[model samples]
Target: MRVLIVEDDAALAERLAALLGEAGLVAETVGDGREAAYLGCTEDYDAAVLDLGLPQLDGISVLRHWREAGRVFPVLILTGRGRWSDKLAGFGAGADDYLTKPFQHEEVVLRIKALLRRAGGHADPVLQAGDLSYDTFAGRFSLHGEPLALTAQEHRILAYLMHRKGAVVSRAEIGEHVYARDLEPDSNTVDVLVGRIRRKLPPGLLVTERGLGFRLVSEPEFRD
Candidate 1:
């Protein structure tokens, strides 16, 4: 899962970014609303944490522009504006959820998870791919009832794939979601990371699609 945080407050932005990162999601931050709007339109973010008050452009405008551009990623408005009108404006501008300031960091993470689940058409917090189980809320993976430990990069790649399980995902798509804006992955970076994940998973669980890309299957016929 990839998230974009658009907040002007440095401390708040850093804190939110760190919290989201700990939740096994790739998070990137931009302090300006113009930049946020551009990134939101350009990047393949699963969700966004947007602040209403912003520099260069306002959050409402940024969100409206995104919607006009047909960017349908879930957006949660995290702002100091507690007025019902502000929330209405956010919703009218195509926000999926709203949260006020002086909020709990855990709640932000939870809301983002719920948004992701709903966006992916998953009502449950846990995602199943064959014998592998991924707890979206806990940011943990278990295979056949055993815990599966993975590096951060591996986790991002697998998480994105699990969210869109059974569908072929290309290397370009993986790079967009797994890596942040500043970290442009090399040609073989995704291949290497997916290789590591394959080592950790059962045989045929993650399969390459030849000229296509990769797919995560919920039912894999493993053979020796």
Candidate 2:
């Protein structure tokens, strides 16, 4: 999972990034809210940790802007304010979860995971498609009770595909989801990754849509 941390405090941001990275999340930190808003709106992040007090633009404004723009990624508000009104305002501004300062690292991680779970439309961290399962938190994949070894990129690609399941995801969409903005865009990257995943997956699991894209079809389709 990729997370963007919008925080002005350099030390705190670094600490949060390190902790999130240790938890197997690709974390990027930005000190100002303008850049945060831009990235949060344009990029495909699994979640965001936003601070209310920010430079250029306040975090609440950023959150509102993203919400207004129809950005649906889950957000966790982190700030020094811990009052009832503040909490209410944060939720009113479209934050999925809230965390106050001086919090334990474990608590932060847990809250982020909870937010991700909710965003994924599943209460559990593991995403399932028939006999195949992928653990989002653990970054692992299994097929029919057997552990499947995968590279980090492969794991991310498969996880993204499995999350969408029956939906056909285009290569462009997959590229935007898996790679950050800095990476070079190649039209065939998603297809290549899908090919690799197909070789690893059990037979008849992944389906290609010719010129369209690919979909995870775990169960056999009924036809006349």
Candidate 3:
């Protein structure tokens, strides 16, 4: 999954980015709210961690702008504002969840995971599609009840697909969520990775729609 971290604290942002990355998410950190607003509108983030105190613009305004632009990614307010009113404002401004400062990094990861699961219409930490299952909390995948080993990139691709299972995901969309902003992947990168994943998956599970894109179907009959 992909997440945006909007925090003015450089050190804290870096730490959160590292922790989220370790949790199998492609995390991008932006210190300014204006930049955050722009990226949130333009990028395909699964979720975001936003701080109320941001440079150039406040977090509330940025979030409001994103919502106005119809960007529906789940956002968790991570600020030092612990008051109930502050939290109400955050929620009023379109935050999906709230976390105060001096929070545990692990909790942040868990909250992000929960937001992702909820956004994906999944209540449980373990997401299942046929014999393939992904434990979002454990950051592990299982096939036919056995552990599935995948490289970091492969894991990200599969996780993103699993979250949006049954929908055709374009390669460009995959690239945006799978890689960091600075790293521009080659045009064939997603095709190569998907091919690798297809080899590991059961036949007819991951289907290609030629000019369209790829979809992970729970049943073989759903394939195009």
Candidate 4:
């Protein structure tokens, strides 16, 4: 999943990005709230970690603007204020959850996971495709009930693909969802990752459309 972190604290934003990355999620940060708001509305992110205090534009207004524009992705408000009014305003403005600052990092991760599950219409965190089953919270992929070993990059690619199952995802689209903004899309890393997935997954799990992109098939192929 790709997440947008809106916070002016450079250190804190980077720390959050790293934490999300380690959890098999892609993240990008914007120190300015206006740019953050622009990206939140323009780009596709599974969720966001938005701070109440921000320069250029306050986080609350940003959230309100997104709601006004009908952008429905789940957003978790992060702020130092723990008052009831603060939380009420956040939810009233369309936030799915709230988190206080100086909080445990794992708490933020957990909240995001909940939002992802609810947003995807998944009653449980487990996602299944054919012979593959993935634990969204555990970030593990299993085939035929046996856990499959995958590199971090492979895991992220597969998770994103599973979420968009049946849709053709281009190389650029995959790169955008799986890697941070700093990573170059021109690199062959994406191709290599897909190749590795083909090797790891059951045959026919993934198929490529020349000049189109790639899609995930939930049914395994049988040989005659």
Candidate 5:
């Protein structure tokens, strides 16, 4: 999964990024809330870890702005505040989950996974696309009961596609979800990844539209 960390403390931000990366997630860190707000509104991140005290703009204000603008990605507030009113205010400001400072790294990762599970509409923790099954929290995939190993990027792409199954997702849409604010690589990156995914899939599942984009063909019959 892809995550954005909005924190001002350089050391803490780097630590969080490294921990998240070790847990098989693509993570990006920004130091200020203005940049956080802009990236949060434009990019397609699965979840965000935000600190309440941020420069340029407070994290609560950033959350309010994104909520007002109808941005729906799950957000987890990580701050030093530990009072009841602060927790209430964080939730009131649209945070899906809250974590206080001096927390266990494992707990933070677990909380983020829980928030993502709730947000993705897969309340059971397992995402299913016909006979294929993927455990969102565990980051494991299986086809017809056999385990399938996938690269981190492949897992992210497949999870995003499966979350929006039946929709015709354009290459640009996939790119935005995979790489947030990072400059676009060549145009064929999406195609190359899709090709790799197709080779791993059983017989006929993923479908490509002639001049459009790609879709996961869930029906029994396949389409070109």
Candidate 6:
């Protein structure tokens, strides 16, 4: 899964990204609130870490705008403001959870994991679809109670697809979330990767719509 980190403090953002990476999450960091707001609205992040004191726009405004735009992904507020009123305002602005600064890194990770689980409709820490199970914390996938071997790219692709289970995700959307900001991806890389992933998955688990994109479904689909 991928998460967006919006913090003006470059050090903190990078640190959080590193921590998220170690925890099996792909993290995209943006130091500007306006940019964060834009990405938060446009990107398909599993969750987001938003700082209240942002440069261009405050975190509350960003959250409000994202909510207004129908961005339903979970957002956790990370801020130095400890006042109860601050938290109340954040909740009012549509933040799912709040964390004051100087908190534990473990807490942050746990909060994000909780948000991810809820967002994916998972009642447990492990994300499961039928016989397919993925341990989000370990970045390991299991099929029919056996470990499924997958390359890093393949795992990332599968994780994203599983998170958006029934939605038709385009190759472009997959690329945006799977690839790093500095890496230049080939036009058909996602397609190739999806084909590779499909080989390992059970037949009919992954489907491609002629002109749209790919989707991970719980059952087989009827072809014309």
For every candidate in turn, the CA RMSD to the true structure comes to: 1.6, 2.4, 1.5, 2.4, 2.0, 2.5
| Superior candidate under lDDT, 2 versus 4 | 4
C-alpha-based local distance difference test score of model 1:
0.90
RMSD of 5: 2.0
Candidate 1 — which residues are off by over 4 angstroms? 221-224
Q: Write the per-residue lDDT of candidate 5 for residues 57-169, one digit (tens) a residue.
A: 99999999889989888999999999989999999999999999889867777788778777756677787777788776677889888998788777777877776677788
Clashing residue pairs in candidate 1 are: 130-218
Error of 4 at 67 (Å): 2.9
| Model 3 C-alpha lDDT per residue in residues 1-224, reported as the tens digit of each score | 78999999999999999999998998999999899999999888889999999989999999999999999999999998899999999999899999998899889999999999889888888988788999999999999999998999999999999889889999888888888877747759889999999999888889998898899887764533
Would you list the clashing residue pairs of candidate 6? none
TM per candidate comes to 0.95, 0.88, 0.95, 0.87, 0.89, 0.85
* lDDT agreement with native, every candidate: 0.90, 0.82, 0.90, 0.86, 0.82, 0.85
Instruction: In model 3, state the lDDT of residue 89.
Output: 90
TM-score, candidate number 3: 0.95
Off by over 4 Å in 4: 187-189, 221-224
Candidate 4, pairs of clashing residues? none
Candidate 4 C-alpha lDDT tens digits along 1-224: 78999989999899888888888999889899899889988887778999999999998999999989889989999999999999999999999999887899888887887788777676778887788998888878899899899988888889888877777899988877777767746637788889989898888879887688888877864445
Model 4 TM: 0.87
> Distance (Å) between predicted and true CA of 123, model 6?
2.7
Ten residues in a row with the worst lDDT in model 1?
215-224
Report the lDDT tens digits of candidate 2 across residue range 5-31. 899998988898888766656678999
Deviation in angstroms for 21 in model 4? 1.0
Write one digit per residue (lDDT tens) for candidate 6, span 200-220: 888888999878999898775
* lDDT (tens digit, per residue) of candidate 1 on 56-132: 99999999999999999999999999999999999999999999988998899999988998898887899999899
